[model samples]
Target: MGGERVGRGRGTPLRAVAYAAGGVVLLAGCASMPDSGDLRGVESTPRQDTQVRVFAMPPSEDASSAQIVQGFLEALTSDDPDYKTARQYLTPEAAKTWRPELSTTVLSDVPDAQPDRPDQDDTGSLTYTLTGTKVATVDAQQAYAPASGAYNKLVHLTKRTKSGEWRIDEVPQGVVMGKSDFQRNYMSVDKYYFASNTPGAGEGFLPTAVADPVYVRSHVDPTTRMVRSLIGGPTNWLKPAVRSSFPPGTALREDTGALTPDDRGRLTVPLNDEAAEVGTARCEEMAAQLLLTLRTLSPAVEEAELRTGDRQLCTLSQKGADDVAGRGALHRPGYLYFVDDEHRLVRIAAGGSDSQPDPVPGALGEGEKALRSVAVARDERTAAGVSLDGGSLYVGSLAPGGALGEPVLRSRGKTEEDRLTAPSWDAQGGLWVADRDPGEPGLYLLAEGAEEPLRVRTPDLDGRVRAVRVAADGVRIALVVEKGDRRSLLVGRIDRSPADGGTDEGQAVTVVGLRSATPELEQVTAMSWAGDSRLVVVGREQGGVEQMRYVAVDGSTPDVPPPAALTGVKAVTASEDERAPLVAYSVDGIVRLPSGAQWQKVTEGTAPVYPG
Candidate 1:
C-alpha cells in the first residue's frame, strides 16, 4: 500500500499481474495485432505443471519515486540468489553497500509506504516512511526470534539529472516482508551439534545431538547453505551448550558447488585445510554431524563422506553415525506408561498392536502409594512419580523387585494445586520439578536423580510456574507460568556450575534467558517436547476454542499440520522420537493417535508419559 501521490509524472501506468493455475499472466492495455506478419507455428518444451518460479519485474524507465520503493520491496520476496534484481532499484552506492543478509524483519502484513513532502533544498530528493507491525526476525546467523511492537523505517530516493531515473539511495539494513512472504521464501532447518560439558557424557559414551534451528532460503541451494551454516558453528544463543566437531575455520572447499545426494543417497562434503588434519575418530564425528543435519532436509541422505582436496578424511554410514551420536529419529520408547484407574503405574508396548496393559515391575506399580503423575528416565531404568496428594516426589528403579525409597524431594505447599508439578528427566539423569507454593514458589532439580535437590534460580521469572519439562539435551527447559487465570509457555536456557565452598555447596543451576514460546496462547493447559526443537502444545488463542499444534522454540508454528482434534485434553505426552504415537488424556480416557489415523481410546488412565 502506498500513500497519496502528488502526480503521475512521466512514468507509465502500472500494469497488474494475476496468478493463474498454470502460470502468471500479465494484464496489459489493449494493443493492435500485426496482420501482415508471417504466421509460423512456434514449438515449445512442455514443463511440469507443478514446477513454478516467480521472478520480480525490473523497474521501468522513468519510474516515479513511489513505484521505485514498491518495486524494491517486492523484489526482496523473490527467489533470486544474492538479490541481484533488488539492487537494481537502488543507487550505485546503496546497491554496493546494502546487505540483505544482515537480518530479516518480518511484519504482520505488507508494509505501508507513505511519501513525505518534497525537500525544499533538494527538489530531486524525496523520502518514504515504511511502517508495519513487527512479527519476528531472522538474524545473520539465521536464528529466528519472536519480535513485537511497531516497525518504522525510512527509505530515501533521488532522481538522476542525466537519465531522469529514480532509484533508492538510502534503505533499511535488511529486507522486510510480511509473514506470508517469509513463509514462502524461507524454511526452517535444524543444525546438529554435540552437547558440551554434560556430566558423564565423555569418551566411549554416545554424544547427544543438540538441535539449533535456523532459517535458510527455500529456493537457493539449501543443502549447500545448510552445510555451510553447520560448519560455521552453532548460533550464539546455543554456542555455550553445544560444540561443533569441525575444527575452527573449517569451511566448504572453495571449488565445491551445489551439494546433492548421489544415486546411492551418499553426500560427499569437501572441506578446507582446517579439517584435513583431524584424526580418524574426530573426522567420523564431524561426518556424523553432517549426516544428522542433512537428514533433516533430505531423508534420502543415508551416508556422508568427508573429503579434503583429493584425499578422503572419513566416511560414515547412517548406522555408523547413529553409533557416534544418538539416533533421535529412529528411537522409540519401550512403552507408553500411564497412571491406570487404580492409580498405579502401568504400561503397554509402545509399538505393539495387541499388547495388554500391565503394571510396571517397580514399587510404584504395586499401588502402595496412589500416584498423580510420572516421568521415566531416558534409559527407562528409573522412574519418578508425585504422590496423589502431590506433596511428595519419589524415585524408583524400573527393574523387577525394585523397592520404593523415601521421597527424594517434598513440597511444603499446603494444597494439592500448590504442590509439586509433574517431574521431567533430562538425558543426564537429572530430574526437574517446580513448586507452586504461593509464598515460596521455586524450580528444583535433582542431579543424577539422587543428589540433594537444587533450587534453580529464575531471576527473570514473573509468575508462579505450573509445569516443567526439560529437553533431552539437558540444556533447555520449558515452563508453564501462570500469573493469574492466564498461563503462558516459556522456554529458558539451563546454566550449570559446580558449587565452590558455600553454605549450600552443590551443583548450582539457573534457568535464564526466558522467552515466550507461545505468546499467542492465552492459556497453556499441557505441553510436551515432540522433537529436538519442537513442542506439541495444547493451548487456545485469546478468546478461541481449545486446540493443539506444534510450535518451535522460537515461537513460530512449524509447517506440519496439527494433530487430530480431541475434546477436553487434560494431559499430553510425546517421545523425543517423533515417530512415536501421541498419547493424551482426554474426556474419552487415555487415547493414542497412530500415524495418519484418528485417536483410539486406550484403557482408562490419566497422565500418560513416554521416556523423556
Candidate 2:
C-alpha cells in the first residue's frame, strides 16, 4: 500500500475573532482561507441534495491507541478536502508521509480494530490490526474495480514521551472505508474519447465519442476534476480501444482553479502549453469532448471555450460539439420497434408509449415473413430481422417501396434455440449477430451489411455466446454467455485490423479482453446498452429473485438505483438516449418504464427493441 507523497503547503494557524456588528464569535482556522491578495471568485456547482455535513473531531487528551485508530478511520470518511483532521491522529512524521489520494480500499463494512501486543522492549508503543472483507478498490486514477477477499492492515501507534499521548506512527498509505461511505463520497462520471482506428467523417462515418467512466469525489470541484481526468486520458482497460483528443502531457493550466460555468452558461478552460499550438479542427474536437463530459455534471453549460495563456484556442457551442463527434445521447430514436402480436415488425412513437403501433414500411412489416427478432440501424434507414424459426437473417430498407432481400445469412442448427440470436447494428453501419449452433457456434459481423458475414474471433470466450449487442461506439460489445446451466454477462473489446499475411478484404476481426460485467448474477436473461458506457441488464443472483440493474463497462455498479422491478422479464431493450423510455417484454407483454414512472403495458408484443 505504499504510495508517492503529494505536497500540501503549510498555512497560518487558527485564530479567534469577534464581529462588532452581529456580536458573533468565530474560532476559524486561518489556514482554511486564502491569504490577503488579489481576490478571485471561485464558482461552484450547488450541492444536489441537502446531505448532512460531518466534520471529523480531533483526538481528545489522553486518548488510547484504539481511540486514535477509530478516530482516524472516521476522519477518512469525512469530506475533509485534504484529510487534515485525520492527520491529527498521526505523529508529525507519519502525517507528513501519508498519502490518502493514492487509492481507496472499500470494505463490506466498517473495519474492526483489534489491539495487538506491544514489543516487550518497547512497551510504550502499541499496534492495532484492522480487519474487514474487501469489496472493491478505487485507484489513484479514480477507476473502480470489484475486489474480493480479506483486508488486513496494521496501524502502529507510539506514545509521545513528553506528553504521554498516543499517536499513530504508521498506517496504510491510502484511506479505507465501507462501501456505503464510498458511494456517499464519490460519483461516477463518463469522460468522452474518440474511438481509435475507426472510419472518419470523409468516409461517411462521424467519429463517435466513447464513454470512459471513472469515479470522482462528490461535492468537490468535480467539473475541474473531471476535466483534468479527461485530459489525463482514458483508463487502462479502455486505453487500447479509444484515444483522447488532447495531446500527450496536456493538462489544465496550473493557475486555473475550480471551473464553473458563467452567468451565460459558458465554461472557459485554460489548458497547458501542450495544447496551445493545436490546429483549429483538433482544438474544436477537444472542446467537443470537454463540453460533452461536463454537460453530464452541469447541464446549464451550453458552450465551452478553450484557452492557452491569453490566447483562445477554440470556442464550441453545444450544437457545434455535436457535429464534431456523435454522442449517442444526441441521436434519439424516433420509435420503439418490436415484433408485434401478429409476428410483424411494428413501431410506436418513441415518446408516446401509449400510441398505437403501425407496421414498419418494409416486406417484414408486410407480414410476408414472420420475424422472431429484429435490429434497426442507428440511421433507421435499414433493418435486419431474424426469421420466426431463427434460421435466417434478412436485411431491408425501412422505406415503403423497399423489398426484403434474400437471407443474408443462415444457420443450420437443429432447433430454434440453437439458431441466430438477435442482430445488432454498430455506429459504423456494421451488423453483428451470434450463432448458437452447438456444432458451429460463432459470432459473425457484416461490414455495412453488404459484404459476406465474417466469423469474428472470440479466442477468450469460455462458453457459447447466447446473445450479443454492439455498443454505439463500435469499440465494445456486450455478450450473454452460457456455460453448463449458468449464464453471465461479459463485455469485450472489438479489434479490427488487417490479418497477418492477408489483404484488406481479409481483415482480422476479434472480440478480445472479455471481462465479466455481472459476476454477481448467476443467470442473465437479457440486456441492452442503456447509455454511453452503461448496460441495463436482467438477471438473478444465485438463489435470488430476478432483478434489473445498470452496470458500467468497467465492471463496477453505477451509483444509480436499480430500475422499477418487473417479473418474468424475457427481453429488455433501451436506447442510447437516456431520456428514452425503457421497453421490455415480460409475462405481461410489452411494457415501458418512463423516467420516474412505473412500468406500463404498451402492447401484447414480444422481442421489443430500440434502434441499435
Candidate 3:
C-alpha cells in the first residue's frame, strides 16, 4: 500500500493564513499560493434529502477518467468485477480517447457491511474514506437511469439520474466540486484560455522560448495515478518564476532550487527544495505536467514561472521529439513497447503508416539522435542481446557517458546476418524472433540468456509472415500471415496435454475467416495484442489507406460475432496500464489519449524519441 492522508471530513475548514488582505497576487509565472482559510476543518455537507442509489449501468467502453474512478469504487462492493459499465458511458470518440485506461483495473478489499436498501435510506454512506475523484463529460443525447441502492455488510448506496438529463459528471468530492462556482462563471464565456492562451503576456510573467511537446508518462503503482516525465522541453525559458511545489495532495513552499543544464544540454530542475517544502508525496508530482504551451500564434511564455511567494521554484517548458532526417517518412518504429519485470515482452506496440503522427512540433537534437540508435540495437535478438521493456528503460541509451559512443551492440553470426527486423518480447522471459531459415520461414523463441533457439513452427500457416506478438500472460501468441495475396489471422496456443509434457502439436486457431479473406488487406504489416483475447492489427486497405482493426480471439466459441470495426488508426502503442491498452496513434500528426475526454496532439511531423 502507498502513503495515506486523512482529511477530517468533506466539510473540514481550510487552514493556513491568507497571504495578504489583497489576496496573494499570482505573478504571471507564479502559480503557487499559501493555503487559505482553515484547512484542518474543511468539510462538505450532503445535499438535502440525501437519497443514494446503486445504479448498475454498464462500465465505460473506453474507461475515461470518470469511468476509471467510478469503476474503481464500484469494484469495492459489486460481485461482477468488470469494466463494462465504464465503457457504456463513452461515445466512440471519447471511448477511443480513453481506450488505454479501459484495460486497467483496481482491486479493493470489500467492507464487512453495506448500507441499507435504496428504498429505506435517504442518505447513502460508506465506511471507507474516499481519496480520489473521477471527472467525465456525459452526453446529452443519451438517457440513463440510476440503479436501486443495495445494502449488505459492505457499503450503502442510493442513486438516480438527476432529473433524467444526462450530464458529464465527476465525483462530489472532486477538485471541480470546490471550484464549481468559478467553473460555472468561466464556462459562461463559452471558452477560456489556459496556459499560453491567457491574455496580456510578458517576460518574468510570460515570455517566449520553448521545448517541443511530447512527454513520457508513468503511473504510480496500485493507484494508477499518473506521473509524467519531463523530457526534452525548454526548461530555461521560464526558470525565474518557479515557486512552491506539491505532490498529489501536499504543498511545499521552501528550500527549492534552480534549473541547471547538463553536459548533454538536457535541463535538470532541482526538486530538493520543492520536495522539502511540500513533502515527498505531493511535491513528487507537482512538476509532472508541462507548465506552459510553447506553440501559439504569438508564442509568448507568460507567468512562465510558478512561484510560491519569494522563492523561484520549478521552471516551464515545451515538449516534442524531432526527427529531421526521418521527416515525412511512414514507417512503424516498434519503439513503443512493454514487457514483464524480467525484460521479456508481454506485449508490443502495433500500428503502421495508418496510425497518427506525433502532434507536438519539434525535431530531435544530436543527443536524441544517438539515443534512438542504441534502442534499436538493444532490441535486436539475433545477436543474443537483452529484450527491452516499455516500463523498464535502458538508462545508457537515454543518457550516455564518456565516448562509449552511443551503446551499440555487436551482431550475431558471420557479422552479416540479415538485419534484425520485427524483434519483440514474450511473457515467458524469452525473445520472439522471425526469420526465413533456408526455405522454411517461421518464428522462433529465444529464452533469456540462452544462445540456442527453440523453433516455433506452424506448418498450417500459409503465405509470408507479417508480424507476431505474445500476450501478457504468455498463454497465446498472435501471428499475421499472408496467403495468395489475401491475409489471415491465426492465434496459436501452446498445445500440451496434462500428461504429455515434452513437445507441441503446432496447431493454431484461425481467427480470420470470411473477413480476412479479402485482397484489400494485402499490405498488412503488424499486429499487437490489446487484451487477453483482443488483438489490434495494422494494414493497408484497397486504396492504400492505412488502417488498424480489432479482433477478439474466441476459438472455442467460433460462432461468436467479430469485434466492431474502427478506422483512422495510424500508430497504436500498448499503454503501460493494461486496462488502457492502446494509445498514441497518428493520422497526420500524433494524437494520444490524454485522459478520457480528449485526444491530445502529442507530436507532429516525424516523431522524435526521448532518450530513455
Using all chains and alpha carbons, the TM-scores for the candidates as numbered come to: 0.91, 0.88, 0.30
Residue range 192-229, candidate 3, lDDT tens digits:
01122111122243211111111111111100111112
- Give the per-residue lDDT of model 2 (tens digit) for 132-204: 8898888988888888899999888888999987788999999988777677678889889989855442345
- Model 2 clashes, total count: 0
Which pairs of residues collide in candidate 1? none
Task: Return the lDDT, model 1, position 220.
Answer: 72
List clashing residue pairs in candidate 2: none
Expressed as tens digits, the lDDT of each residue in 199-276 for candidate 1 is 645787888888889999877778899999999999988887778899999999999989998999989999999998
Candidates 2 and 3 compared by lDDT, better number: 2
C-alpha lDDT of all candidate models, in order = 0.82, 0.82, 0.30
Task: Give candidate 1 regions above 4 Å deviation.
Answer: 1-51, 118-122, 354-356, 501-506
- lDDT rank order: 1, 2, 3
Which prediction has the highest TM-score against the true structure?
Answer: 1
